[model samples]
Target chain A: MKMKQALLTLTATAGLLAALPAAAQFQKPEDAVKYRKAAFTVMATHFSRIGAMAQGRASFDGAAAAANAEIVADLAKLPFAGFVEGTSGTEKGSPKANVWSERAKFDAGAKKMQDEVAKLAVAAKANNLDQLKAAFGSAAQTCKACHDDFRNP
Target chain B: MKMKQALLTLTATAGLLAALPAAAQFQKPEDAVKYRKAAFTVMATHFSRIGAMAQGRASFDGAAAAANAEIVADLAKLPFAGFVEGTSGTEKGSPKANVWSERAKFDAGAKKMQDEVAKLAVAAKANNLDQLKAAFGSAAQTCKACHDDFRNP
Candidate 1:
């Protein structure tokens, strides 16, 4: 039994080691694109759900709204990590050179979006539709601001 | 400024009270339909991303795989909550009435899917590709199982 347990531990350790290089975030440019896009899509999905409620187009399920807000806040941190160097190839890069060139501005826009989404999460948890609307619009503007300058149209 | 802040607080409080009179859960069947569809779409998108890696079409990004698995696990909890009562209208409801009628069976299937997805998250995080594949297939089976029985064809 002790031998079997030891073997299991060894196997588990090997598997854990396999999972990391230690992922200096992504392994490739395509990875940067795909990861960022997936995270963005998830954000959009959750945002639209809350949008429907805030707009009064759908009946607001407070719990669902709050849950989605939390997820959106969490997702807000994901995209920028994908905005690393060497992801500037024009063919695979929808993000323009300004992301790397105007680094301070791009970072500020990302920060603004994250901050706005975080506030949106707070408003959502409080069930403050008005605050949610305000924060959501703010976040959307940040998205557009960065995209307009940095993203390929 | 103090008076303006107070007035703003007052208006916000009134809006919150108005938004909730109060919702026990969802007040719209259409909300349920849209929410579930959105959750399912997110799941499908993430699964396809991982599927591409697993099938060798895309390079395996360990971080991306782990991130996606976590999202899938979170999303697993979402669609089932949307499958609440009074979501029985066939037009707005993509879920068949059997979801409400065969509630026990449906709940079990949902649980099975959630459990499998949670396992997939664990496997992905561990970088155990073999186990990830196993859990991925299990989760896919659950999707097909539930859809075959309860979702619209």
Candidate 2:
């Protein structure tokens, strides 16, 4: 069982790394860290715009929701590339060490979020408030799940 | 002539503001500043990847160049939204006062950059290194023009 689990982890890690553009894209570990954080910041800003409409805090504009959702989906593919090895931090809101140790699980979470956001993008384009709300909830849950599992509190 | 230029600045500022999603997207001036900086950082990262290929510092990968150029084009529409009122700074690399004081000229520069990047995206899709290089040089010049005119030294 231990050997099988280790093999699975290796496969998962390789798959995740293969999805990245190139290690050369980031010349230093710090660059990777900064890139990932900036990606998250931009993604979150757009995501929150959708959240505002879904929660009734802001008026529902289908065009705006669709635009924001599209940006979110595009950005979803980005931050994972920045999760280079040895860059996990102990600070609050930072990725925990398990991001590397349990690399497969972390990669799974990233994939889940991306999948949810992609769905959210499609749903937002439907121009129905109910559909946007449902999709936003699912996507937000995926974000929380990863933060709970892999990020420091 | 001074009055004519003032009217033009007001018209340009209004047009630019109208293009943004809404002023309510940002809760505070700092948020706008941070959001814009994050957008620029992500855009520059992708832009630099293309630059590497264009300058022959890295191997020319047509597909990669196309992907980077597309991201740059999409991002060209974003950072300008973050240039809210009273956010200009005097520090090096910050937006100069002229960004707001000479709003029309600044907006023109922004549009020029967007146009160049859009062309770069199309050129990159041709998958010809020469075409990519030519488009990349034009796009880079737009970036520099804005930086030279609107950004502080």
Candidate 3:
């Protein structure tokens, strides 16, 4: 019993240690870009999976949807973090020079997107195909609005 | 004939006017983040849409796909301009203090993903579902790889 308790304690400590860097590490622009990109991609792929499930191209795929919902929930938190100012580093194909110039407006957009995505997570959790569809559409719209004004497209 | 020439002149002028801002705007971190978020969201959303089409839950939706492709192709260029050094500002959620520090790797990842998506666009033009599936999967994988190392999750 004592050995099992010790092992549990060790595992808990390791988990805690692992999380420390995640918070401190994501502070860099490159890291923020990486983190947000990762979360967005995961959400995107799972969203595709969910689309598949909804269309019945695949079955209910409850397991996949559940997994996807979990990812979406996490993604809701990422963009705000992506807004961590000073994180922007020189990349090969970044946006216009105006992004840094228009900081207030940009942050507002990010916050708006995060709010919508958060709502999407709730709808996704319900596992109602219709709800997911509606929520996802709304979230995608928020993404588009920001992209239209700020993104290169 | 004079009317036609005038129309031609106007169209050309409009095109130039449109192109000019893409070259001129968004110099700060705030502005860059806003713009980038838009581009990234468009890319992610379109990516999901293509996956939907490939799964056959939806129709070809050629117009939507083409528009999205155009947006993505254009947005791909935005990041390059947004990364000017010293432009990085003090945003709360964008990334961190380190993004500017590790700009090269971030740019590379973005490029890889963009290239993959461009491949998907070609497949989309062919309207070949199988090709779409293959390319989409490839593109998504790049997205996942970046996210795994960079994102919050």
Candidate 4:
């Protein structure tokens, strides 16, 4: 009976591990921090380009908007994998500890942002400024929501 | 005749601009530098994961290798655009001035790396360890060649 219980426990542990995101292994915790920041930086740069067009800060070039949106969508799936344990910071603008403590909510936020960004990509390709603006607004809200909830002020 | 010369000059300038890589605009030179560095950091992290598997330091996982390779290939197209004017540094490991001065050669090097990385992505999907290693070797060589020539010692 003890052996059977051990087997069942092992199976459960394996299932949990499989259920976790495919987090990339890091040589050090600092490496994970750097990677996540880098991913966010690149994603933000492209996303901001779309924001510029959406807000009329820059002229709306449909091709440029679509390209930037595609990049933003591709990158939306990356940074969360780097939110490894014990990597949170107390500094202003850093990821808060609750990212791990409230893992489910954090993940849900990430999924929400990714979904909105994907829609933004589709809207951008339509070559309509109004469609791009609407999608960008939705995606931007997802970003703000996650930041407000998960990041340090 | 002078009017015709002005028009010809304008056309040639447009052709030159068109021949250049599709670089993403940045608000400042520092922003361009940061963007490129972020891109390289992310690409390097993913590439190192495949390197670990290729070198037998990590157990080979075909799906993980393929995923990393795809990220690397996508990123290989990015950093070159950030090599904007006035961003070179004198520090060791910084991009050298020749990256701009020797523009044709630098662009060629970027193209070579991108091509090799694309092949690496395909090889990684083959689920054959030998093929992955071979492709990784070629891709690594391209990276090394660029670093040796265009990066400061």
Candidate 5:
């Protein structure tokens, strides 16, 4: 019985180890670009949902609100993990070549936006509708600023 | 006022009118989902930068912070414009079927998030770091609640 248990443990451990590299392997620039862009798109979509609620374009549901909020929080952290610098170049139909050219500036812009979003996340948990309205406005500006500089269209 | 100039202007207007629809043609679901995911990834990556600053993992610079904050603001709006209800299905590695199945709930969650981020943007403009921090925390929590239910790991 002990032997069987030990074998099971080993199998699980090996499986985990194997999976780690697959996840890690995507750290390449091309892959990072793909990952980052996907995450951003999701985050952007979620933001719209939130906007509908805040602006009275739509109503809110507590359970769904909770889920959307989580998406925002995770998005806040997604960018940091994939920060392989050259990944910027691998993106297609991206804003502009300037994203890579002014990498530091772009990074800095990204960071600021995340920080603000983080703040927005916290406010959201409280369900303070007024506060939420204000925070969303802040987050939206960050998107505009980056696109204006980095995005072509 | 001149006959030739008037004719030329009319011709240009006609040409532009004809070209407009093709230029503004909505993306198909496969393309929309793909493009949206790309945008989401960028937003997520950018969010990390702000997280770093907020946690004091890094320091803040006003100009950079402001710029990134702006990016978040614009990103908030992009997803909604491109939303084609059935498009999400065409994309790979997207959230679960429930995203469309329970779209009203999902939309509510999204709206709440937008409200919070917008508030964050306003706070950022005021240069109120304390308010920013508070708002950021709230926003983060809101995002988590949604992702727990809606997103795939």
Candidate 6:
């Protein structure tokens, strides 16, 4: 728990620099858009697998659930790396300008989501279905909340 | 190198069992398709970042390149977990039936690509541009070759 807290702090600190796109990393703003979208896609991929289990759409196999949750947690830190100012205002599934203008709230939302996903991973590791369900619900709420305010759709 | 050798042998061995879809891991074949596509998408995301630097389309920031390459190496092992017989037909980016019909060649291709990516990671960590280029080129070729034979593109 202490280690997760420390890592969360570090991720929050990294978020400070996140608003500024690393010029050397992307040749254009669209590349940043692509980067963030790709990260989100991966997040969706793993999350969907876990969600299916949670919803009873799929069997709850302990090992697969744990592995998927682990990936979701690790991937939680990646999309924010692409949330630069240049990426907003594009029509191609890019964020609206409010994401940057309301950066604090946006960042808080991101951090909360990350924390929730981390919890999901812990729950998955514990092999406690109840805990995993609660954590997954919390994580999903954070996702919906963030998207409601920050995303295009 | 010993560890890499061990992983490659293990991965190659696992390939022997790849044609059998793990019903425990995926309840539906589409889930497997989605999973592997997501893995490939993530791999492409990170690999392209390094590819840009290797091809001179982006700056060669040593630290970023190394970080990306390391992720690429890790992600290299993921997509195969999705390539099962259940996913070998139809579209939506699933493998062509030839992928299963020629499973041996496909697995060999997969192994070779993973090995080349591992080499790229080493080159990136060394911050040697020439080595990175060579390894990146080789890895890219492996990707194209595999797709040409196994994928519908």
The candidate that wins on lDDT is 2
Per-residue lDDT tens digits for candidate 5, residues B1-153, read 353464344334333322322212243666565655565556554455566666776576555455555556445544543445655542435666687788788767766665555555555555656666776677677677667767766
lDDT of 1 at B24: 32
Off by over 4 Å in 5: A1-153, B1-25, B81-83, B87-93
Best by DockQ: 4
Give the residue spans of candidate 2 off by over 4 A.
Answer: A1-21, B1-18
> Tens digits of per-residue lDDT for model 3 on A4-77?
99999999999678545334434346756654564455455445656666666666644445555554554455
Per-residue CA lDDT of model 1 for B92-132, tens digit only, reads 33778898788879989999999988988988887766666
Tens digits of per-residue lDDT, candidate 3, B60-106, equal 66655655454444444334444445544444334443445776776
Residue by residue across A17-58, what tens digits does model 1's lDDT show?
334432354656666666666667657767877888878887
Q: Residue A123, candidate 2: how far off, in angstroms?
A: 0.7
Worst 10 residues of 2 chain B by lDDT: B6-15
Clashing pairs in 4: none
Native-interface RMSD of candidate 6: 3.5
Question: For candidate 6 chain B, which ten residues in a row score worst on lDDT?
Answer: B16-25
Off by over 4 Å in 3: A1-153, B1-27, B83-93, B96-98
Candidate 1 stretches greater than 4 Å from native: A1-68, A75-111, A119-153, B1-27, B84-93
lDDT of 5 by residue, A11-97 (tens): 999967854533453536676657666776667656776777778876754334444555676566664445453444424446466
Candidate 5, DockQ score (0 to 1)? 0.23
**Per-model CA lDDT versus the true structure:** 0.71, 0.87, 0.57, 0.86, 0.61, 0.77
- TM-score, prediction 1: 0.54
Query: Could you tell me the fnat of model 6?
Result: 0.38
lDDT of 4 at B131: 100
Q: Please give fnat for model 4.
A: 0.71
DockQ of 4: 0.52
Whole-structure CA lDDT of model 2? 0.87
Instruction: Quote fnat for model 5.
Output: 0.62
**How do the predictions measure up, each by TM-score?**
0.54, 0.88, 0.38, 0.89, 0.45, 0.73
